[model samples]
Target: MSNEAYAQQCNVRELMREDANSEVFFQKYTLSEETAARLESIREMLKDDIAQANPLWKVIAGENEEEVYSESETSNNDDESNHNESQMMHDQLVVPSTQFYFTQTERTFVETSDTSAALPQRCDILESACESLERNNGRLDFVQLENLSNEDLIPVVDEMAGKLSLKGIYNLCASMNNMTIEQKIKYLNVLCTHLLLPKIIELEEPSRLLSSAIVECVKNFPDEIQQFIFVPLLNAELKDTMLITTIINSFDLEKKAILLEEFLAYVKELKSWHISILQNFLSVRLDHNMTDKITKLFSGKALYYSKDKTFGKLILSFLKLNTALSQEQKNLMVEVVAVNETLFKRPMENILKNM
Candidate 1:
């Protein structure tokens, strides 16, 4: 063979190796059925020519082409099997458990303003109330608990963390209409600062239950309490995205805009999975102005994590939503998609055509 022919053969072999091993090729770039079949046919036609021109053939398999072919076939099959196995393992590993879990700490004493003589009496009553709750398996004796003033109930609420399950808390809150709105907010604040936020974890189940109970209990409260309590909850260290998302769904469009405004500031640090959930939740009800704001925020940050598959998936979902997008927003999506065409091509094409 001429030097040019040998170099061309080497180039083809390197391209084939890249097709098999490049991460982008293996993951993001998928061949269509027809294209795959055509490539296979081309490979067969070149098999004899490749064996003849290849320099390593004699050193690797000298006059035993069938053995060489079989070994190559086995290696290709192993690559495919390993890829499938890894994909299955990934799917299994990421399946989050539905059980609620949280770390516990010893109860801290909350100060009360009772006189020294009355303090001991309050302590005895608090101890008895806690023991009663423990014996009753976290069920509230509303008649018993109702007789306690708000100051006395605060510590009891703090102690109910591991003792009282969400169902019990929901039931307790559901029966609290008799309390004035201010009193209810005061009580709910303890439930939040003492019970909910302290026990919150990064898992879904605990946050889901806690968020549901909170929304159910306060859904009928005055807007002032929701604004005061719910907005700050969005910034908790282990932020409960489920809670924020649920609150967004439960409120009116105006309330959602307010929540989303707060979310906009925090979303810069949100996990990609959390972003996906927010994408799904926001798709249903975001107004045009809020939608545009979100699009701009995500678009501005899109190119920074452009290679992240989860972030890319989020970009795709955002593009596919039925909400209105400005020309500038659409341009930003196009720019990010261009940066990662392997992952974003088909979806981006569909989005552009629709737009």
Candidate 2:
């Protein structure tokens, strides 16, 4: 054999010995049955080529050692290129199966559905609501009305107030401003009617919106309507202090005095808190002539100082506001202070000093 071929044969034997000893080398070049069969065919072809070239290489090496070295280097380059191409083909075949397995598994693992289905249109929703409102004669149940816009509720208020005589429209009035004064007066009239009187009387607490709407109606309409609305409220079995205060405060001095006189008859039945509200009403008064009536209203009565101190203070403060105090009023102040000296001490001193 030629020297170059002898060296190549020795190198191949060394590589096969290394592959036999190393598990990684063996695994790296291991092939499937089909690939192993194809490799065997290629090995046979290589063996034939080597066998044919051996004699020729020996002749060349004997003539020129440089030619043998060049030929051996060219053979090595070609073998390396063929090995890389085989590795690339093996990678291309193995990678696609791995990628396909993962892609199929991922598709099977996830759930998906079409999410672009249509929803009910806005106009359709409004039309349904309007039809429901009309069926109920524009007086929707409170639950039904809760989801409606204010504009949609306006017609409901008109229909309920005009036809059904329902006072629930007042609850909706806070969000509505399109209601006319006449419409509100009609609602207030319904509120004051004998039919609705029981509902108004049963209310343990007054609605502020309903009370304000009543006041608005009273202000915009005539005094007869005020009397018509207020008298029933005052007589209602469930008396709300805030509602009473609103009604009393809405009246002129003469009307307020008349109400005060009527309230005084029930003073014995009034709560301390109610008395405090009366004190607030009296405290804001600008009339001095009404002082004697207020003083006499509380005079000669065994009033509880702890409970009635606010009213006491209001009376003394009202008296002190006067430029001059009468001898009877001074005596009355002395009597009131004697009853609750501790509570009335500061206001009493101020009044005495002013006198």
Candidate 3:
């Protein structure tokens, strides 16, 4: 064999040996010079093969496969060197191009009834592939759909996304935001239940994972647990408490009423100090976000007290107190009144005379 052939044999043997000792090699110097150089050379060769003018190369260039493959069938072979070179080029071309996605037209053709031999097994493979891709959205590719028909396969995306568990569905939906608008609507489930309150309330995920889940939950699931899990973990409080206060403090008077059960449940579990934390959040000249949440909370509380148990009676009870208003205390009450005069609307006699 020529020196180049010897080198090819050596490379193959070396690669085999490397595979045998791969774990140890990786542990010691996995990212070292030799491995990287070989990998880069392989990549460059694959690129060249993809850019070659051979018939398979032409098929990949958007030509008709029948026309391309018909030409490949008649190619004249001359020598071992030529044969090996062709094999090398073919291998390089096929392997990397697998990363390119099949065109929509091509996919449609494969999935058609004309391809029945492939339809059953191919359909399964396509579904498994889609399910796999939906799980790791960023890493999926079109070429992976090589065996399946595109027309049939595309329809299955909805089913694939739907069939996934809530966690999987969350990931699929979350992945949509990064895609274009059409892509987003395509992957998104229009009837998402967001039943996250039960799921997240009970399970404690890690911080990074929890944040991602929270983000996706907010985008898709608007259920009660969104409030419960959105809280920032202050000291040891269920971060949901902080999130609840934030949400309550930001809602319109309307949404706060609808969400009263969640808010009351939030406060019920909170310590007096945390409730104080929420109360303190209210008695201030604040920005719009804080203002909205408090306005809604107080208004909703007023409504809630009329229909159910809430902080409204506590407000009336405080209103009925007889303690002489200290200057500092009066100033604070003044601040509260500045936001909503409804705060001091009750007669002082109804409060002080009874006290």
TM-score of each: 0.50, 0.40, 0.26
**How many residue pairs clash in each candidate at the backbone level?**
0, 0, 14
What shift in Å separates residue 76 of candidate 2 from its native position after superposition?
99
Tens-place lDDT digits, model 1, residues 113-196: 333345445555555544554442343444455556767776766666665555554554454434566556556556555665
- Count of clashes in candidate 3: 14
User: For model 3, what is the alpha-carbon lDDT of residue 307?
Assistant: 30
Mark the regions of model 2 whose C-alpha exceeds 4 Å error after superposition. 1-202, 229-239, 250-274, 283-289, 300-302, 305-309
List the candidate 3 regions with Cα displacement exceeding 4 Å. 1-174, 186-198, 201-207, 216-355
Number of the predicted model whose lDDT against the real structure is largest: 1
lDDT of each: 0.60, 0.55, 0.46
Q: In model 1, which regions exceed 4 Å deviation?
A: 1-115, 120-125, 132-172, 175-178, 201-212, 222-225, 237-244, 252-255, 265-268, 284-289, 303-310, 322-324, 340-344
Candidate 3 accuracy as lDDT: 0.46
Candidate 3: residue 62 lDDT (0-100)? 55
Residue by residue across 131-224, what tens digits does model 3's lDDT show? 6645644333334444545465545554554455545545543554455545334322321222233333334433344345455445443432
